[model samples]
Target: MTETFPASRLWRDIPDLLFPRQCEGCGVDLAGNGTLFCWDCLAALPYLKPPFCARCGDFVAGDVPGDFVCASCARRAPAFDLARSAFRFDGALAEAVRRLKYRAGVWIAPGLGAFLAETWRAVPEALRGRVDFVTPVPLAPERSRERGYNQAGLLAGALARRLRLPCRGVLRRTRGTKTQTKLSAQERRQNVRGAFAVRAPYRAGNRLWSRWFPPVEGKRILLVDDVITTGATVDECARALKAAGAEAVYALSVARGNG
Candidate 1:
């Protein structure tokens, strides 16, 4: 049986409908519309133009081609085999993401997930087959309890459904760390180091490994996150997966921070 929500209950109880819709970036009232942002606001967002670094997905100024890496990526390479993002985190897009992840705007996941799927479709064919399972960057238990949800998990769930892939919780936060936003690049790296652990009893073929044993043998994983800033969190997760014998690990984000 299909359960249906009452129209009045939906409009009155759902925060996205209850509150007057507004542009996440500029806070302009959108009346009783269901869209998160107005048309003008969406058009004004700083969409990532072409000529981006192939490795990190950061915008590149010059006309470079063929698997280019950014200056920062060249200095210290990322742990993940490859990384991709939907947009450069700036202007209205950044504000919308912030609200979705930090301010409890859970209703925005469908739009964000669809945008990510569209971007992933543009990736080279070589990468399309490397992703076996889609997993979100896990949040600490305490933080998840406080937030009532993990935005990355929500995005990953939607993306996995769209891509026809399994969504699994392969990695877990072993220790709580300070918010990466308040830290410098080097500090962010240090903060997330050794912060993640692969969960046990992982399903492998027709067998389940013992809780005391690792089961990430020869698996290809696609790690999902809301945004990539310093790349520290994903790096840590990748390192843990590699240590557990994952064949390959790639990352995807809805946006990449401009810093």
Candidate 2:
């Protein structure tokens, strides 16, 4: 007897044999594994578990009672109603985020975005709220031109598609600032202050190209980003969104940075 297979399967196999998929985390040949990561790297993903902040989603160190909000949130609350992340920014997750941001590893975005969508679904409805729109923390015009793309926007689009929501460009960066990597939390907050504005609707040369003005007033929004550190950036974005009459804003990111 002769073995048989579908033509579509054989066609797909050609690419797998010609150019094997590599693990996004470690750049290892996938060896027919259908995932973006190899078994080891997938298992090593630093997923954040419970016992975290009720507001900021920072991982708590020890056992805590119900509804633990971190000291940072208690001291100076974030502008967003709530926030959460899927993974801790370290090891494989950190490398993947860096690659997506600095090294043009846009291919890694879909996987990261999937993780974000999964994390958001796990949040209780009471906390996550009714998200009306999904939007990215905008990049400044100059920085955006230089980078060629916004990593946050890519993540936001992927996440919104999964959630079956309308993704819109609801905010714009008003100015460019220095990197926040080495800045103190206070400095970080100051740097991004008044740096964002709600992107207003505008008409382009082609009427079809024009964007519909986002109806944020009295509506909830979910801000998406690649990572959240001091939460300053997202908070600034939330500030702008709320000022524009958004009822509530919640932030969701692929990973949580050490702040």
Error of 2 at 7 (Å): 33
Residue-wise lDDT of candidate 1 within 1-259, one digit each (tens)? Answer: 1123335644564776345477666778988575567788878866666688777677777787666678988998877877788878887888778767766667778678777787777888875566778889999888787676888998998898888987888888999998777898899999999999888744565354433233567988888999988788888899999998888888889888842
Please list the C-alpha lDDT of all candidates, in the order they appear.
0.78, 0.82
Error of 2 at 38 (Å): 1.4
In model 2, which regions exceed 4 Å deviation? 1-20, 31-34, 202-211
Task: Show the lowest summed lDDT stretch of 10 residues, model 2.
Answer: 1-10
**On residues 1-259, what C-alpha lDDT tens digit does candidate 2 reach at each position?**
1123345654666665344488877889987455567889999998998888999888878799888889999998888999999999988888888877875555667777788889999999867667888999988787676666888998998899889998888788888887888999999999999999986644555454334445578979999988899899999999999899899999999889762
Q: Highest TM-score among the candidates is held by which one? A: 2
> Model 1 Cα displacement at 186 (Å)?
1.4
